[model samples]
Target: MSRRQSELEGRLDDMLSRIAMETQEIKELEQQLTDGQILANEVLQRDLEGIISGLQEYLRGLRDQARRSQQQVDSLQAENQSLQLHLEDSQRHCRQLEDRARTHTQDMSVQQEELSVLRTEAHALRDRQVESSRQQEELEVELQQLREELARQVTLGQLERGALLAAVDKEKQSTEIRECQLQATIDTLQDEKSSLQQITLRLQAQLDQTRTQYTETRDHLDQTRLQLDRFTAAMLDPQEVQSGPDDLDEDKYRYHYYNFIFQQDLAPAQTARSTKTWFDVHAITVLDWPANSPDLNPTENLWGILKRKMRGTRPNNKEELTASIKEIWASITPRQCHVASRQ
Candidate 1:
């Protein structure tokens, strides 16, 4: 019985040992699984963090891209608005140009028609000129023949009168005293007649010369009239004539310079001796006077200023004086004219 009890105890111990070994192997396997699970959880958490970070970066990039796109869109919109405004302006300009072109074309057409009419009138005037030239040639030839005939008549009369005087001088010698008295009277009459003939000839020549001068002046006047007529015709249209108040004012000012002679006189307050000494000082004269005078006088006033400026300086010659005058004139201004005219 003691041996059987011991054998049972050993069997129980062997079974307990086998069970502990299996339990230990099970525990090791569970620990390994737990470790694997923890490792997997850690890996998953890291991956999730990585994904979140990537998503955040992508979102940030998207936001920046969106901002850039919005800015680009805004710039494009502004550009579009600018282009639209330019297009409208260009369209308005084109319309204005088109209107001006139409008006210009119409004006050109009218001008062409007027030019055709003027050409026809010119042709007619040329024909009339040819006819008038033929008539003038005939008149000139007739005038030359008349002058020649008058000259021949005067020569023939002189020859006949000389022969008669020679015959009378021989016959009247016998009739002594009576003949001498008659001869003296005849001689006095012949001298007086000769003088009268010379006076007549001179008067006729003067009359012919006067007639010729008159004809030339008349022809010149006619030519001037014709030129004025043509000019008036050519510049008849109000639209074509660009004259304005400014042009008229310019012409008025220009006319003032045509006969403007500047003179200087002595001042009223000076004594005769002193006045003579300073006759040209601080004195100005305008020689021309008209109903409508331009309100400017610096051209003449500057001469007085120039004289004042040259009071101490003596010019050597006309050349130096002219150069000095040019310098002084160049220094004058329109404002000076305005002030001078007011004074």
Candidate 2:
């Protein structure tokens, strides 16, 4: 770049020198013309003027060319600066490319080493494939033997299965026989159950009839007793009953007792004593009465008879006592009541 600048400067200097020399020569010629122009021909004077104009034009052209050259040099210097920057950028890019190429070369070398190792592994795998093929053939032979053995075992298994099926069939037949036996037993049990059910129904019917007869007999007995009580109470020897203020308390007690027994006065009014305590304390069937008043509440007499019977039988529990009482109560006939009433 410096050499090119120097060359351009040299050319411009040479041009300037040539222009100076030409100007000097032209000045000398002008002096000669001024000194010899009066003796010179018009042709010579015209030639001198043409020469001077030509020299002036040439000088102007040279000056213009020099100016153009200077402009061109400046342009070239700007271009050189741009090109230098571009060259530096290019150099940097080339260096990067070189670095990349070197890295690629290293990578390629490593890849080549890996490829060699892969080749060795491939060769080993190939040998292993050959060995595996041999082993596969051996295994195929073993498989054939195993298949033969398996086929034999399968035949044995089939035979065993046949035996098992036979046994299963025998077991199934035995199970069927047992089922038939069980069915027969079930039929017998069903017959027995039917007989028992018939007996139970007959017994239930008899029980119902007995309960009806008992209820009627008991109702008749109760009616008879009530009539006898009323009769006995009515036979009061025509005496005038004297009412005293103390008798009023006894009368109120009797009223409350009857009310409690009959479930009268749903929410009873509070009295001297709660009637609830009376029920908790006493049973309506059991009562305290004088000797002559025995006929007034004949249920007391029945309870006394029942208690006498219960006293002889030692019961372990209330249930047994209740059952015995219920049985004895059910056994009580109208004859028994009549006898008791007579007594």
Candidate 3:
């Protein structure tokens, strides 16, 4: 009985020890699983944070793009309105010019008709003078024959002689009166010719002036049309306006500069004085700019930066140039914008 009891106690200790070993193994496995799960959760959290940050940045970019689109639309609408008004005015002026041209043309036609009539009448008067002179020569020869006949027939009655002389005198007086009337007609025709020539010259001058005005108006209208066409094309596809790298380069530089100028309305009074003719021609309003300002121009600095950025890239086409420019612009940091603003 004592031997059996001791054997039973030893078996229980062995079983207990085996159970403790199994329990220790299970704890170790649970600790490894927990550690793996924690590590996975941390990695997932980091990935989600990155995704959220990227989405937020994309959303901001979209908002900014939308804002810029709206501003461009507003500016285009305003410019279109102004162009419409200018077109209407131009059309109205064209109509007035047409009316004046028509008036001048009609006046010229009337003057031409008067001139033609005067020329015909002057020619008729010259023909009549030639016929009158021939008739006068014939009458003078007949009078001389009558005087010789009278001298040869002196034995005849004195009354017959007296009658012949009286008839000759009467005929001479009639010829003199007719000559004076013809001379008066010729002088009158000469006066009309001179007046008509003066009128013709004056009308020609007016016609030339009208032609010049019409040409100028047409040119102005053509310029306006071209401007509207360019604006429409730009509205449809902004890239269409960029013909080449040089154009894009200049335009990009001007874009930043003009934006800065417009945002602060910089140098308003100075611009009015410097570009008076240009402003007056365009009829643009000059807003109030800060006074007595230093010329802190930022475009030159931006140009230098842009040139440096574009040093390595040589675009072969307009599209390539445009893409390169866009890429460079996107790469420009906020610090650059801040620096430009400060300047």
Best by TM-score: 2
lDDT by residue for model 2 (137-188), tens: 9999999999899999999999999999999999999999999999999999
User: What is every candidate's alpha-carbon RMSD to the true fold?
Assistant: 39.6, 32.4, 48.8
Candidate 1, after superposition: displacement of residue 269 in Å?
68
* Candidate 1 lDDT, 1-343, residue by residue in tens: 3354456556655755665575566556556677777677567657756765675566566556656666877899999999999999999999999999999999999999999999999999999999999999999999999999989999999999999898888777756878788999999999999999999999999999999999999999977765554444334434323554223322113223334455333335532656545433423233444444543545666666667777756779999988877877788787866667676
Model 3 alpha-carbon miss at residue 234, Å = 2.1
lDDT of 3 by residue, 196-279 (tens): 999999999999999999999999997776565556545544785776333432322323222232223454664566576645
> Model 3: how far is 94 from its true place, Å?
99
Q: How much lDDT does each candidate structure score?
A: 0.69, 0.70, 0.72
Instruction: Please give the lDDT score for candidate 2.
Output: 0.70
Give candidate 1 regions above 4 Å deviation.
Answer: 1-62, 89-93, 142-343
Candidate 3 local accuracy as lDDT?
0.72
Q: Weakest 10 consecutive residues, lDDT, candidate 1?
A: 245-254
**Model 3 has how many clashing residue pairs?**
0
Worst 10 residues of 2 by lDDT: 244-253
- Candidate 3 Cα deviation (angstroms), residue 123: 78
lDDT of model 3 at position 96 = 100
**Alpha-carbon shift of residue 13 in model 1 (angstroms):** 74
